[model samples]
Each structure stands twice: as structure tokens, then as C-alpha cells.
Target: MGVKNNIIAAIDIGTTKIVAIMGEIDSDGRLRIIGMEKTVSRGVKRGVIHSIEDTIGAIREVVDRLQAKSNKNISKVYVGIAGQHIRSIKNRQFKYIQNGVGEISKLDVEEILNENFRIPIEVGEQILHVIPQDFVVDKEAGIRNPVGMAGRRLDGNFNIIIGRTASARNIEKCVKEVGLEIEELVLEPLASSLAVLSEEEKEAGVVLVDIGGGTTDITVYFDGILRHTAVIPFGGDIVTRDIKEGCSVLIKQAEALKIQFGEAVADLVDEEKVVTIPSVGGWDPKEISFKTLAQIIQCRMEEIIESVKFQIELTGLHDKIGAGIVLTGGGALLRNLDVLTQRKTGIDVRIGYPDSTSKIILDEALNQPIYATGIGLILNGLNKPIENEKDLGNDKDTGSKMNLFKRFFGAMFDTED
Candidate 1:
């Protein structure tokens, strides 16, 4: 059994579901999943908490189940946050090195990084994460690490993520009400990338599109640095809504049809195939053609892909994305989504799963895309450096993972019967 102190826990408070997961970083340093619990979310919409009471109730339910499954009390947990109001902007700042002509110390780097928190923003909004994109030492550009480098001044380019203060406060209040403390509020897109993206893909330039129930979170990485992040107000829920209205079916039925029969490309669906939808209030059962359902799904999914394309273009890295697009999240499970995304974007595409790489030990039940954010939260928390405790920026720590990568080829797994 692993030490209790090494048990890392995280909660993914998503729009459609709330997931509580606990893992332990073993002596070998590989992360092993011990338990996970998920339940339907009733208070969050589009990644924002709308009703404190409902969200609090849902959080307690999942947390209680998780504690029982693991037989450990969880106090502090890392949480993931995203929504329509979340946005990111690029900024650059420069500061002179202390005692010119001397080596730049870690203090010099932290000085400029902390200055980002002072950047101007609209009322009622605050910066959430400041990811250092690159560093320029003595006017030399594209330096990732400037420590121990001789320089007169330091210039840091950063991607600053901002969100509504009210949203974050609500999330904190809900978690606190449920007897839990938040370790940090991680951006959902950033966390998702950690789970699905490979070091090679990030270096070669890749775009991650995480289509959650209420919003689609997109993050663009180039030259192994985070370049841009955005959240589209539309996501899987919108597609379900479209199906509900177009096919004249209930929301639950629409969602079920989408999971069981929805297709991203209409041409691939059989025109003659039809599924009977259960009727309500003694009405006759309604039969909808598969092609019609697919057509509705395809139209909406095309919009999403176009939005994703537009976002990639905004980053000015559309042509430089060597690894292309990696789609994940619950919506990515739709039939033939990868094919549609590739054809529409005119770039190679692949569905990203939690086990797409050999980094984390896989729990067969958590291999699905829906659990990416929850799992990534644990990894992100474990990867955070203690030195970052004083730094105001987020996602800047990228050191070796507790010397765990050496066992990548031979992952350690422990599952209960």
C-alpha cells in the first residue's frame, strides 16, 4: 500500500458531471489510480456554477463515495475550471538584471512573472493563470530557461488566462461548503492537454480541442510552449439540444440517440435505417431516420469544427501545427468524429484517450476521454514544484515528473477485483 501522504485527489466540476478521483504516486513514482466517483451535475452549466446549493450537494455525494471507496479522508484537492467568460491574452514585460553583467537568478524571473498579475483587466475579472511562453535574455529571443545565463535584462512573454471573479468565488464557496479545500484552480484546457498530449506533439505544434458538455476548451501549443487558450460557448450540450429540437425528442432521448447512433458525417449513415424513440404521455412512438439524425449532428459538429479552425487560425499557427488536431472529451465519442474533423480541417486528426501514451498507469474504466480532465488534475498537482508556491503564475513548472518517466514503458498498475 502507498503512503497516505502521497495520495493526491482532484475534483473535475464539469457542466454535465462531477468527478472525484484519488491516486497515489508510488515509490517507483508512477501515478496509480486508487478510486474515482462521478455523478450527474445539477448546478453547473457551460463550466460555471450557477446554483451553490445544488453544486454543493453534488460535490458532497461524489466526495463521500470516493472516500468510502478509498477508505481515506480527503481534505485538499486540485480543481479544474473553464467557461465562456474565460479568456487568454498575450503580454510581454522586461526587467533589468540585478548588477548588470551578472548571471540572472531565479528571483529575476519571478519578478517579471509576478508583474503579470498587475496587468489591467475589466472590472469584476481577475487573472487565473500566467504561463510563461518564452524568455529573452539580453535581447536574445526564444530562450526557455535563462537561469545562470549572463544577461543585462530579461524579457518574458506570457499567455495570461483571465476569468470572471464571481465564477471562481462560487466554485470556491461550493467546495468549502462541502468540507474541502482547493489546492489550485487549474484551467481545464491546460489540464486536458497534460493528459492527452505527448511531449513530441507539443514540440511539433498541436491543437487540443476538449468538447465538454457545456463548452469546448481549446489550447494551442507550439515549440513545446503554450501559445494560446480559448473557450467556445458551444459544446456537446448544444448538439444534444439540436437533436432534441430537430427530431422532436426529449433531451434524454436525444442524448441517448447521440451516444448510441449519432454520426459526425451524414453521408456515412444508412438512409434506410431508423430508430423508434419512446413516446411520452401515451403518444405513438416516433421513428426518425438515422440519416436525419446524422444530418442534424453533422451540421452542428461542422460549426464546432469551423470554430476550432478559426481559433487555430487566430493563433497564427494553423500552418505550423505538425501534429494537427487531437480531439478529446465526452463529445469526441461520437461516431466518426475524427474522420469529420480531419476532412473539415484538412489536417490529420485523432481521438485522444487518457491512455494514448505510456505516461500514467491506465485504469481500464478511466481509459475513456470523459475522464481526461479529472486524471490530468492529479498529474498536474503532482507535477507542481514546491518553489512555485511563491510564484503568482501557473503552469510554469515542467521539471522531470518525480523521476517517473523512466518506467514509461513498464507502467505499474493496481486494480481491485
Candidate 2:
């Protein structure tokens, strides 16, 4: 019971929302959400913090509310990270057998992977994830889980996700400043994929598009392997801003209208409908045609979806998405967004939510698409083999004691992560 009570928190710091969700690993190896809070984001845009002070204030507000909601202490967190600066690419690694051997061992596989991490990347880019795509032995090209097969050569194809070193550092600094330990940093889109994507979807191949407040993140998975990841710096904010300029209205007013009455397709609007706007000088309130407002929003959202389509084409993954696309994030909740995406990208689309896997039925508040990132982060750690793992014989003298002789001269605090 004491062990199951260890809380895991996921702080999803997005451009327009700051979320802190607390969950505990119950007896069934599932993350049970005990506390969840989201606050209006400040000094953050396009998933990057511009002012640490304002961001910290937002984080504190959410943390305070989450604590009060669950009466649980959440001091460590697995934060979700994303931004336009993140990038990824595919790489291959090959290792020749040392002795032209009879059998390949796990150590040999580890050495090959360790060398792959040494692949030359830009100085400011830090490797976040190295997902194995497949293994090639001799002439065979698609072999997954190639641990035990006699082969003189071991080769692997991987998709390496990297981000600007500064963004990575900033994520760590901000979370640590909030008196919380950084357990892990999961990319927002990648985390969302983990939360909403099913085994069938992954195996059948799918493209996940997360249209967030300030940016759209894309991830493509084929044959149960991540193939491409890209972060495009455009999202719902662009549409709102376009409305502000296109409709000649205040930003606040434009934002309100965009959410309340905005439509992604202009042709769908009824030409007779009109939305009234309160006049700026308290003069006569002007009534604007809903068709015009819808047009302005449609143009911007259309462009954004165009870019999404381009990404799919760029990856050469347009025809590979057998499961089509999974749309999640604040932007995905936009009316007819899924339909627009399907039309523009020529792929079937659906709004994704963690509710599909969640068992709680709580009046659609926590069920919103906004909770995807936080829930995904929690789901990531929950999938790990933590529970149902009994200790092996003489556990104390096993994994940890292998390097004891080398640790005798150094303090325990000096051990590295």
C-alpha cells in the first residue's frame, strides 16, 4: 500500500495552458488520476517560455489547485515538452561481428545502440528519443526484436527525435524552480500519441496531429514504429489573430467570436445569419454577417491544414496511414476540424481523447481534449513494468551491486544519473 501511494505528476506546460495532473500507480499497474488542474498560461507562446516569472506564477496556481483537489503532495513530475524547435530524423547503425560469430548476445546489441547515439548531430540539438524502426540481418530487412538470431552482422534503423538544447534546458530549469524533481520530459505530441493511440492503430500505421494553442505537432508511426516527427509553428492562435485583423476587431473579441461561432469551412455558414459586435466607442452596435466571420476563420484554418497535408506528403507517409489520422489538442476540439483535416489531407480523421481508455465518468470536465497531454504523460509511465514485478532471488546483490567495487571510493551523492 505504501509503495502504491507514490504519486506521479505530469506538468504539461503548453503555450495557452498550464496543467498539472497527479496520479498514483494502483495495484493493477494503471495510473488513477487523483488530482488535475489547468490554468491560463502566461508568458508562453508556441510552447516556449518567454518570461520565467509569469510562467512560474501559472505553474504555482495550477499546482496549488491540484494539491488542494486531491490532498496529495506532488513533488516530482514527468513534464511534457514541445515547441517549433523540436526536430527528428532517421538514422541507421551497423555493427560487424567481432569474431564472425555463431550467436549474437544482448551485450552486442547494446554496444551497437550505444554507438548509434554517437551519431553526429548539431551542437545545440539534444537527443530525446531513439525509437527502433526495424532490424536488418544480412539480406533480411524487417526484423523486430532481433535479440536471439545467429547473424554475423547487426543493423538497426531508428528515428531519432532531437530538440534545441536551450529548449531542453529551459524545460528543466522551469520545472526544478517549482520545487519539483524532473522525472522525465515527454514530447507533447509523442505523449499524446501514447495516450490515445491503440495497438491496432500503431500496427496498422497512423499519423497523429496535435493542433495545440500556438503550434501543431506531427508524429507518424508505421508498423508500430515512429517514422517522422515535426513541429510546425502554426495553430489556433493564428486563426484568432487572422480574425482580429480580418474582421477589424479587438483581439479579445476576435478570440471570443472564433471559439463561440467560428466555422472551419466558409461554405457551411448560413448567409442570413449575422453576429452583433458591441461598438468600440459605445456607438451603435454593428452587426457583422456570420458568413464573413466564418470566411476569415476558414482561410486561416485552411492554411494551417494545408501545412499539415504538406508534412504528410513530405514524409512520404501519405499513403502509409492505414489507420488515418488521430487529432488531439485544444485545436482539435474546434468544430469540424476533423472533417476539414480529412478533406484537406485525403485521410480519414477523428478527434482523439484520453476518455477512450479512461474509466472515469465525470461530467465531461476532465474529459475535454485539453487533458490529452497531461493524461498521456501519466499513461507513459503507467505502461512501464512497475507493478506485477516481483523481486528476483537475492535482489540486493544483483543489478545494483555490480559496480559496488568502483563506488567504494566515491560518495553515494556523487553517483551520476
Model 1 clash pairs are none
TM-score of each: 0.91, 0.88
Provide the overall lDDT of each model, using Cα atoms, as 2-decimal numbers. Answer: 0.83, 0.75
Superposed by TM-score, candidate 1 places the C-alpha of residue 394 at a distance from the truth, in angstroms, of: 18
Question: For candidate 1, what is the lDDT?
Answer: 0.83
- Candidate 1 lDDT over 1-417, as tens digits, reads 112477788999999999999988777877788899999999999999998999999999999999997899999888988999998888999998776648887657666777888999999998888777878988799887776788888998888889999999999999999988887787888778878999889989999999999999999999877888889999999999999999888899999999999999999988999999777988779999999999999999999999999999998998999998999999999999999999999989988888765557867989889999998888776654343243323334322221111112111101111
Model 2 vs. true fold: TM: 0.88
Encode model 2's per-residue lDDT on 18-131: one tens digit a residue. Answer: 998877776655567778888889878899888888888888888888888887777767788899988888888888766455555555555555555678899888877666
